[model samples]
Target chain A: MSGYNEYFDKIKLNEEQHQAILDAVKKEEALLSQAAENTKQKSSDTAKIRFMRRAGLIASCAALLALVIIFPLGKRQSMTPANDKIPEADTVMSSDIRSEGADASLSGEKEVRTDAALSPQENIAADPGSIPAPAEEPVASIITDAVIPNTAKSDHAFPEESDRSAAPANEPYECEFAHSIEKSGEETGEEGPVLVEASVSDGLLIFNGKSYRYLEETITDESAFDAGCLAVITVGGDALLDPALLDIRSGMFLYGKEPYDRLYIRLSEDRFLCFVPEDN
Target chain B: MKTAEEMVSAYENMLYRAALSHTGNCEDAQDMVQETFIRWLTKRPVFESDEHEKAWLLRVVINLCRNYVSKKGNRGNAELLDIYPAADPEEQSLIEDVMSLPAKYRDVIYLFYYEGFSTKEIAEILNTRESTVRSQLLRARNMLKGRLEAEL
Candidate 1:
């Protein structure tokens, strides 16, 4: 391409010049390799960070699940305690009345509560002859054929007098309560109602091998009863009968399994009326 | 497909020659080549073929040299023989004459004569029309011939 071919040949790189360019290229190559290595390291570090984030998310989910499972159990335990604070019995019949009527006075709570701790003799003096006449079929069946929802497992028990004696007042004791407070106090010649007397007349309603007799108590006090009818608690506190019309007065007998975890009334051979209390 | 070292080895001489045509000095040529490779490491552009890859390297070296020349603004300071200091005087004279030309003429001359790139290939490498490369080559050769004859 040039008339100066000889001249072009003369300026060709000598050994030293050739070596110098080669050395520079090699140096640049080394720097470039190091740069490549640094890039790989950066990518690897990013991947590790992503993995750690996933692991952290999983750990957070597990922690949330553990809290969900443990919280309810913890709350239920907090509601209860090692030592009992609740009354062993419901002589005030406040809960029974309260269920039947929302606006009933709490005065009965004070009256029964004072003598709640008293022995049978003291209970007789406190309100001797103060038994609300046991209406053959109370004036009105305030709580009739009322089947408490059976959502929870009932606190099961067989008839045990010791079980009913005294426990924490906060917890309701499901025990073998007597048939009628007045009738039991009468046998002892005491005036007012005390704890019910144990009767195994119709085979003990055995719960966990202990017998629980059905002590049916009806709250029919018109002023005290907002429903203006009667509310009867099945002896075992398993059933209540609330009749919409107070005039239709009929009592339902308690019948269930031997352990009596649930109570059922045989309406007939084919039909069965069953219920579970709310505070099981 | 090429490792960093392989790419450098494969393209270094060609890129060096193109950069030397642009800057006319060994130092600036080396700087251009190194800078081009540094860009390669950073940008890592995708290439369709080996020709595309080589064209990319050549383009980068040429651009870097062009930028170096404009920033330096002392194009005449480089005497080709003095830049490399060849052991042979005739080669020195010829290279000095080539370097003395304007960068546009020098690029055509280098790619056409020394590198044996066709007018069309040189045009593609320099991003110019083949006709422009042809005219530049003719002008470079005429200038070189006149200078050599006078020196003789």
Candidate 2:
């Protein structure tokens, strides 16, 4: 063989070696096929696991709703209109009410008492400790007129002394807010309910969420207020400083120590929604 | 319509040989051949003739083998090269010398002499002009001849 051909011939495989190469090729092909199959199965299993997880999430949500319906406590009443009368409780419980075990009947069936049909008077009388004096009298009277049996209305269920004391009375709250907001760019002031989630610095109320600091001079109106307090003016949720009652929205600026002497800005409406603690 | 079975059967040996020339390992050569066959089957190239089909398969196999060899590194991995020994004194020395040569010259020599591809075929497979292929082959031959003579 020529020098060049010798090199080529040297590189060439014998029959046995050629067969070995073919066998290797076949083995590699089988491996690729196995890898492809494994990938497919893995993808399908992953999809199934994801689907099951989603279904579990939905089922858990449904179970939580069912649990809420199975238990009831009287705390803050549900704000929703599903119930006609508020339970006579300082704190309204959630909707579901289950009766504790009663003696089994001859038929061995459980007896359950549903709270839905209870008269307002009965519910209120059941927990006199929960009623607020004076503030709840009118509401209780309305409930008596609307829900009590005719004979029960004539019977005084509330202590007569409690009746005299239950009339609504005006409660005044001195409002003060720590003004802490970084005041810059077209000055914006928020007046209404002061947020309790705030830190108060020397004559400045730092809004808990908003990082703003305002000067006491910028408070155009002033009124009676306490430090570290938030007054939730019922109407339009106007939380503001008492001594500095400036209607920043109307562009009306009041200047004086008794800034609150200016007409109390009713919520959006001219009626008092209620004075709630800033924490509320 | 070229079928995968026919293509695999027709060019399997050629692809294996080309991969062996590039990787100098029976296992990697086999992988390159299998991969090349798969690529060919997937692309379903409409070859002008059997020669075109063979050349395309060999080109893919060589390129894949080259990539594998480089990724594995050419030095200090005796375990891989031990499976497939060089065929003769000339061939073994040629492979060692080519392996030492820069990849550009080694590619041309492997395609031209070991693979038995003409300069024109090499040019077509390499996506270069025919003149470039001819010049490359001449340069590769000279480089290998010099290196082999130096070894002797």
Candidate 3:
């Protein structure tokens, strides 16, 4: 073992080799330190990028939330009319007119008699304490027109006839009807006109279980009608003698003469009826 | 933990000699020693005593040399004798014989004879059982004895 020790002990590095190892160790340490510093710098850059991305996402979300909150309020503000702030009497009169329009058939005769007994100005003068006079002439005229029935205003049954004689010959009379479809047939029975079921299918109007080709020019707009409802067919504002059926869903009213006469149907606020000719 | 210069100065020669015996070449042995020091610098292992530090360095160098030899499939270089020539013919012959031994045998012999480690300490350094180290030592000795006797 001593002999083996002596042999192994003889093996030693020269001065040059020892210096080379020291130099290599120094070089490696520098490289490692530089690598660690670069890694730390990369980590910092990554963290900054992540923070900016998160901030951008948060900002986008906040902008969307602000739009969501503001949009509905803007719409509501636009919906309210600027001229809605009227006097108390005008407001009451407008409300009464709307109620009368709702139940016009039941109480229409009584309102017409009252309006006939006293003029708008005479009524305000006679019952100055109970009824206040309208501040404006246009407002007073609107109240008179709403209260007075078409039959009371003229001898003719239809208001369009009176409108043609009173107003300019070129101007057309526009009638604004109530937003209700009255089922007259079942309720009135034999006393009044019977309104049967009606439908429009494939460019043909199915009325009283008979298909009739309606005038194409009369159909100003295409409106879909619902089922299981009764409607009356009116000619020159008068119900047909045979009592034709019409499906008046969506507050629709079908009127006008047949056999090439103009038909009027009111479906929506912006849309009106297309007439059906008697020949078709 | 010691600085690179301190570690290199303290254990470089010892590690180099052990690496040389396992690697069988001066260039590979120096490379193994340098790599061992680099690891020591990077790892910064704490030691209780000088012996513990020396043992740790020797184990690292020996393991590095083993890995180099395994990867390169290098047995022994004939030029090993030229690097450090002995004064006596017999001592030179003994060195050659020791180098000629298997890597495991040479490791146990170097730690036991040159480093003055017990069989148990040699096993711990080599990460083997003490009985295995003892058996390897005995077999290495018998092979050396036979070669020396034949030469004589």
How many residue pairs clash (N, CA or C atoms closer than 3 angstroms) in each of the candidate models, in the order given?
23, 43, 2
The candidates score, on chain A by TM-score, as follows 0.32, 0.24, 0.30
Tens digits of per-residue lDDT for model 3 on A1-280?
5656776677787899999999999899898889889999999889989999999999999988988888787655532321121132233334444553344446433222123224434534554443312223342233232121122212323224343234222212222111111233333464322224344444344455544333222222323322111122332121222323232222222221111123333232223334333232
- DockQ of candidate 2? 0.07
* Candidate ordering by lDDT (highest first): 3, 1, 2
Q: Write the per-residue lDDT of candidate 1 for residues A190-241, one digit (tens) a residue.
A: 6432344322223133322233323322123313322211223343232333
Ranked by DockQ, the better of candidates 1 and 3 is 3
Which digits, one per residue and each the tens of the lDDT, describe model 1 over residues B1-152?
A: 67666776677777877777687676677677767877886677899998889878887788777777888874562565554564467766777777788988877776677767788888898898999998988888899889989999
List, for all models, the DockQ compared with the true complex. Answer: 0.10, 0.07, 0.51
- lDDT over C-alpha atoms for residue B19 of model 3: 90
Error of 3 at B78 (Å): 3.5
Candidate 1 runs further than 4 Å off: A3-43, A73-280, B2-11, B41-53, B75-78, B83-96, B142-152
lDDT of 3 by residue, B31-68 (tens): 99999999987887899998888888888989988888
Every model's Cα RMSD, please? Answer: 16.1, 25.4, 16.2
How does model 1 fare in lDDT?
Answer: 0.52
In model 1 chain A, where is the ten-residue run with the lowest total lDDT?
A: A243-252
